[model samples]
Target: MKRVALLVLPALLLAGCAAKEAEPASAGLTVTGRYPLEYAEQFTIDECAGGYSLVTIGEERYLVVPEDAPLPTGLEQDLTILQQPIENIYLVSTSVMDPIISIGALDSIALSGTQADGWYLRQAREAMENGEIAYAGRYSTPDYETILNADCGLAIENTMIYHTPEVKEQLERFGIPVLVERSSYEENPLARMEWVKLYGLLLGKKEQAEQQFAEAEQRIAPLADQPSTGKTVAFFSITSNGLATVRKGNDYVARMIEMAGGDYVFADLTDNGNNLATVNLSLENFYAGAKDADVLIYNSTIEGEVDSLAALLEKCPLLADCKAVQQGNVWCTAQSLFQQSMELPDLILDMNRVFTQENPPESELKFLTKIQ
Candidate 1:
C-alpha cells in the first residue's frame, strides 16, 4: 500500500466556525506519525496517551494503535485495542459502506451485515452478488462461525451493536478487534462527513479522504451566508401506533435544516443532555406544534414511503390542518437517505431549494419526493 502524508488543515466545526489547526507540519510527503482530527471530538490522537489514539463513542472507548507502533503503556483491559492496517474487515455499519467504497478500498471489506437486496448502493449490492462480499448476519445476531472461518481481522460496528455487548466480547474471543463508528453523533453534517478521514487513515488512503471532504465542504460553501428564508420546517415520521417521531433540534438533521436557511419547527424540544436523535411524540402534540410549519418533510426512512398526499393524510388525518399540508408543501424523503451518507451535501442543496423556492426544480432533487 502507498502511504500518503496528509495535513489536517482548518476544517468545519460546529456553528459554521473554522477549526484551528492543531500544529504546524513540515512540507512534502513525510509521515508525521500522528493522526490529527479536525472535527471529530469523540476521538483524539495523543502521543502522551501512550502513543495510541483514544476514540470515545457514546459510553464505549477504544484504543487504536498502528500495527507497527509500540503498545501504549498503562492501557486498561476494558478498552478494545485496534492495531491498524485493518484489512479483512467485517463492516457492520451500512452507512460506512459508501465512504469506504469511495476511497477505492472496497476490496478491503470481507463481510457485510446487510443483505444484497437490502443495500441501496449499487456497488455494495453487486459485490454481494458477485461473492466479493459475504453476509454474516447483522450487528446483534452475527454468524460467529462464518466470521471466524473467514478470519476477519477487524470488525467495524455502528452504535446499534452497543446494545449487544456480548457480541463484541464473542468476536474479541476469536482475536478480532472491534471499533465502533460514531460519526452519526456529530452535530454538524460536515463534521460527520469529515469522519471519512478516520477511515482513510486506517486504510492508508488519507489523501483521498481529505480531498473528498474538501469537495463536500465546497459544495456547501455557497449556503453558509445565504439569507434565511424564515420558512419553518417539520421533519417527522409517523409510527404504526400513531406517535410522531422527530429529530431533536440539536441533531445533525435538524442542524442541516437550519443551515439551509429554514427554521426547524421543533427547536424547543432540544435538551442538551438528551443524546438520542429522535423523540417520540403524541400525535396530538405533534399536530399542535407542527400545524403552522411552512414545509413538511416526511422521514420515510422510519415511517415508510407514502405514494401520495392522500396516503399521507390517511395515515394522519390531523395533519390536514398543518399549514404545509393545506398549502400542498409536503415531501417525503427516500429510504436511501440514511444509508447514502456521501450524498449529504446534495441533500442540503435540495432542502435549500425547497425552503427558498415556491416550486423547486424537482428534476435535480436527490432524496426528496414531492407529495402529489
Candidate 2:
C-alpha cells in the first residue's frame, strides 16, 4: 500500500490569517458566514489526495475536498474545538507567555507550568487568580495527564520537546496537539514577538496578536537610534555546575541589550539555532572578556532575595574583579528568560527600562514587581 502523506499545516502561514475576513466563496463549500477556526476545529481538518487538500475554515491555507476521500489506514482521527477562544492555555515555556498575556489572552489561560509569583509570571498573576488558573508545576514536570483532563485545547511547548520525545509522543497519543514555539530561539526580539501570531492562529485571535506586535515594534525601533554613553553589558546563565554560560552573539537577550542601547560583549559569536550556543568560557577566559563589562545581569532561580548573585560570584573567582561587580552594576533578575515562549515583548520593555536612562517608566511597569 502507498503510504499517504499527512497533510501538514505550516504554522507560519496559519498564523498570518488568524483574524482575516472570511472569504465568500471557498471552492464549492459555501463556508456559511466564515468565522475564525476555533482551537479544536483548527486541527480536525485532515489532508486528502496524497496530502494536497485540507478541510477547514480559518486563516490557514486549507483545501476543500470531497468528504469520501480515504484517510491513511491506522491513523487516528479526533475532533477538538476551542470553546472559549483559548482563555485558559497551559504554558510549557515562559519565554513567550507574557507576550501572549500582554496581548489580552491572560484570562483564557487555564494553567501555567511556572508559578505566578515569578517576575514574568506576575504579568498574568491577576488574571490567573481571578480566573482561577491552576499551576501544574515546572516546565520539566508539567502534569500532562491533568492538563489534558482539564480540557486544555492547546499546549504551547518549547523546543525542549526534542529532549523528551516520549512526552511529545504521549501528548499526540492523547489527541492533544503540541505547537512548537521557537521565539526563544529567535535572534531578534522583534522576530520573537512576530511569533505571537502563532498563538493567535490557534485561538482565532490573530488580529490581536498582530496589533500587539506592531505596537511593541513601534516602541522599540526608536531606541535603535538613541545614543548610548554607558559601558557595555553581558548576560549569562549560571548552570548547575556553576559554569557561566554566555549567551551567543545571536541570542535574543543579546539583541535586547543592543536594542536597549547597550553593547553586547558577545555579539560576535554565531548562534547555533538553538537557544544556546557553543561559547564556553572558563574563569580566565570570562575574566579576559568581561573584566571591563559595564553591567552584568545574572539569571537567578531563587525569588525574593538578592543573595544568589553573591553566592554565584563567591563560587566563581574570575567574577570577583570584574568591573560590573566592582562598581555595583550587577543585577539579579529571574531566570524566566530561559523558558519564555510568547512573552518577549515585555522582556524587551523590561530591558529597555533597566538599560536606558532617558526613557520614562510606563504605567505598566508599576504593576511589574521584580522577583527581589
Candidate 3:
C-alpha cells in the first residue's frame, strides 16, 4: 500500500505540470479593439505588482494576471490599468479633462480646454491665471499653431472630432499622439466613468484613476436605490427660435435625469446618438408634455443680473403655464453643466437636488445650487 501511494503522488504531480504547460499565455489579460483615433497603436506588456503583466493597448492600458491569481483588493477584476508615465500632455476635450483631474494628473497637463466659470474649470482657474497651464481653445476649434508650437507630447481628444481628419493628420505630423476617449457617447454613465482607467494609463496614474472611479461608483450606486416621491422630469434647452430642444433618451443628461430619481419623459424617444437635436414643439405641445414636471431647469447662459430668469421667462411665454413655473419650481442650471470638464458625479448630485422634494443631506448636496 505504501509503494502504491508513492507512485500515485508522482503521477499526480506530473499531470499538474502537464496541464500548466498546456495553458495559453496572456489568457486573462484584457485587450481592447482598435482605437477610434488612428494615431494610437498596440501595447506591450510589462511586469506589474504581484507578478502580473500590465498590458498596454495604445494609450488605453490595463493590467493582466494569471487566472489563478488573487484579485486585487478594492478593485474590480475586469478593470484595466495604465502602467506608463506621460509627459507634457495637451487635452482638447472637456470630457477628457475631468477624468484627468479626478486622477490627480492635472499638474502634468501643459494645456487643456478653456477655463470657463464652471466649477471643475474654476478649480484649475488659478493654474491658468498663474500661467502654469494654457488654454488651447475649444475642443472643436483648437488653435493649431498654439498646439504645434507648444511643448506637447500628447493630445487627448473626444470622438466628436472624427470628422476632422485633416486636422488630426496635421497634429500627428508634429509627432504629437492623439488619443480619443468615447465615454461621453456611451449609454451608461458607469461605462463612461470606466474609461477613466484610459486617462490613468496615459498619465501613468492607474492606481489613482482606479481609486477615483471606485469612489464615484460608490457615490452613484446608492442614488439608484434611493426612494423617490417627486414627479417625473424632462430637460430642455431653449433654441434661438423659441423652440425647446428636449434631451433625447440616451444622451448623458437623460442618464443624469434617471440617476436623480426622476423618469426622463423622453426616455421613449429613439434618436439616441444626437447630442443636440431640435425637438420643434409648439407651446401647446410643450405645456401638454411637461406641465406636470416637478422641476423646470433651464441653462442660464447669462453671467450678470441684467438678464435674469424672470427676464428670460418673459421672452418665452410658453413656459409660463408650466407647473414648475406656476409653483416657482423654475431653476437655472449653470451653462457649465454642458461643459465637458465638469465631473459627472457632481452633475448627478446637482440633478438630484433640483428634482428631489426634500433637499439632499449636506454631503450629498455638495455641488448643487438653486436657480435664484
Number of the top-ranking candidate, with lDDT as the measure? 1
lDDT of 3 by residue, 1-372 (tens): 000000001111111111212322233322222222211222333444344544444344344333346533333333343223445667767666667777888787777666534434664666777777787776667777776566666676765567876666666566565665655555666666767766665556778977877787777777877876455786665666666667567666677778777787767765744544335566567667788887766644323221355774665677777777777666555555444332577778767776664554445543344443
TM-score of 2: 0.66
Give lDDT for model 1.
0.78
Ranking by lDDT: 1, 3, 2
Residue 278 of model 3, lDDT score? 30
TM match of model 1 to true structure: 0.86
lDDT tens digits, residues 40-151, model 2?
2223233222322233423223333222343222211321222223434677766656666656776556777766575356656765566577887665676876676667
What TM-score against the true fold does each predicted structure earn?
Answer: 0.86, 0.66, 0.69
Q: How well is each residue in 20-133 modelled by candidate 1, as lDDT tens digits?
A: 333212121111234566666655433222334545555555555666875534344455566666677889998898888888889888889999999989999999999999
| lDDT measured at residue 20 in model 3 versus the true structure, 0 to 100 | 19
User: For model 3, how many clashes?
Assistant: 3
